[model samples]
Target: MSNSGHPKDHGRRRGLMLVLSSPSGAGKTTLSKMLLDEFSDVKLSVSATTREPRPNEVNGKDYFFKTQDEFRAMIDRREFLEWAHVFDKYYGTPKADTEARLEDGQDVLFDVDWQGADALHDQMPNDVVSVFILPPSIAALEERLKNRPGSSPDMVARRMEDAKREIMHWRRYDYVIVNDSLDVAYQRLKRILLVERLKRLRQLDLEDLVRGLLGEA
Candidate 1:
């Protein structure tokens, strides 16, 4: 959201804030991991959380673990770009770190729910590119949820119910892809990112470069 420290290069541009959202069992997490693994320029947005860390969850890597009072103080100081209360814990994207990465020309990928995506886009409209993933059909979605490891029948049913509600928000996204095949969907997702990187508005020095070419400067 913050672009104050951007470099002055015609070829280099500001980083993207790519938001991927989907219901459970829709393959959003899989795609997010793929992007991170394949792209060096893309970094997952690490959030600050007011929750006890689970085993092997390192602070400042998995999350910026904070005490409740510290988290509340951050909220009061407007340190977060987007913050949410979920399941009695505070989670937020710290503005400074995100802005620093963007200024360094590194795209930040956000693997968030629709609500989180909406909050991000609302706060930073120009930098956000939102995508919603979908299952091929309701039956397919059900099957995926059922087959998930350690998922009980009740858990699957609850997730299925949540999926229906989540799917309703797909129209709010800039793009939607039905993840019928993981490979095909990944290709499409990659293409979207590549094309978005080439957007004219994002290229900060094009106007000057073009003028120099035409001898108009």
Candidate 2:
């Protein structure tokens, strides 16, 4: 390890795909933002979508907005690592840019739902480190949805229903975080990323380093 105590500081390594999934009102998005702010090497994977951008959403920063025809063309070209039809819209991860980033040793973070997470793992199982975030309780989740800016009663009800289905897939993830306390959950998320980054298989120069240590170099 180098001065930073990170194995990546000492050797070259392929970066990981960190998949974070949760229901709409859960804290996965918040945790993802915290991780990105903390780790300079990690970048968010901007997805391509057919949905209309919400307020304050940017074109490339939030999502690559595409028409239905454009999205279908991309699908035909096999340009997506994974794609899913969600909530009457198409959403996908672009393959080329994400692969390039991984090869350059930059971790990509995915803030997706369970369907997207499943699709990503199916396509790139070895590279994916999946985490599922859960609300502490259903009541808490309802409160969160209701407290959202401009949240209506119908929208909250619909999201609550979706949350129940999403919570059932928690067991599929490598790690599960109950985001009762934002600080505690963020720390756990950071620890997971750090430990995963230090795994032996991710250290590309380990073989040479070990040989030198044993006087074989």
Candidate 3:
């Protein structure tokens, strides 16, 4: 680890893999959008999926839609950083794009579940910072799911059941934010990102600062 308060000069500035995981109605998606909009250096990693796009969802912007066979082919080719089956649809983060972004010293944001977050950390241990969002209560979660205009009663029930399972993995993440209010949750998420961005280990250029302070060339 680099000195906590000092700067370094040897290595290039490192990138961060920020994973935001939450249950279906926990407000992670909303928080992610806020972070993306607020941070100019952060890039959203668009996942590839086998599921059909929803209304107003662009193919490459929202997700890279692929046929099941194409997705499987990528899997066989080892093109994904992490891939998983969710609700019978294949979803994956393409390895090349994420690497390229990191190499350019850009932070990548992932809005995925715990399984995906774990897989990402396994692949890139040093770069990842995982956060889990929580609803204030199960009742609030159920109400949020039910209030979504496009969801049917059965869909809401299914999400609630899945939420319980997802919430069980909360302890695995580095930070947990209980989203009681959108504005408060967004601010908390933003703060986490900003603090992590300044971590000494992530700022490899600190070596120079240390050397300079010691009067070394």
The candidate that wins on TM-score is 1
Task: List, residue by residue over 25-72, the lDDT tens digit for candidate 2.
Answer: 888788887888778889999899999999999998889999999999
Task: Note the residue pairs that clash in candidate 3.
Answer: 7-206, 8-205, 8-206, 8-207, 8-208, 9-205, 9-207, 9-208
Weakest 10 consecutive residues, lDDT, candidate 2?
1-10
The weakest ten consecutive residues by lDDT in model 3 span 1-10
Error of 2 at 56 (Å): 8.1
Alpha-carbon lDDT of model 2? 0.89
Q: What TM-score fits each model?
A: 0.92, 0.86, 0.83
- In model 3, the runs with Cα more than 4 Å from the true position are 1-12, 50-60, 64-70, 86-89
RMSD of each: 4.8, 3.4, 5.2
- Residue 156 shift from truth in candidate 2, angstroms: 1.6
Write the residue-wise lDDT of candidate 1 on 1-217 in tens digits.
Answer: 2333333335878898999999999999999988888787789999999999999999988999999999999999999888999899999999898888888888999988888888888888888999999999999999998888999999999999999999999989999999999999998998888888888878877888999999998
Better of 2 and 3 by lDDT: 2
- Name the runs in model 2 displaced over 4 angstroms: 1-8, 50-61, 65-70, 86-89, 211-217
Candidate 1 has a TM-score of: 0.92
lDDT at position 90, candidate 3:
96
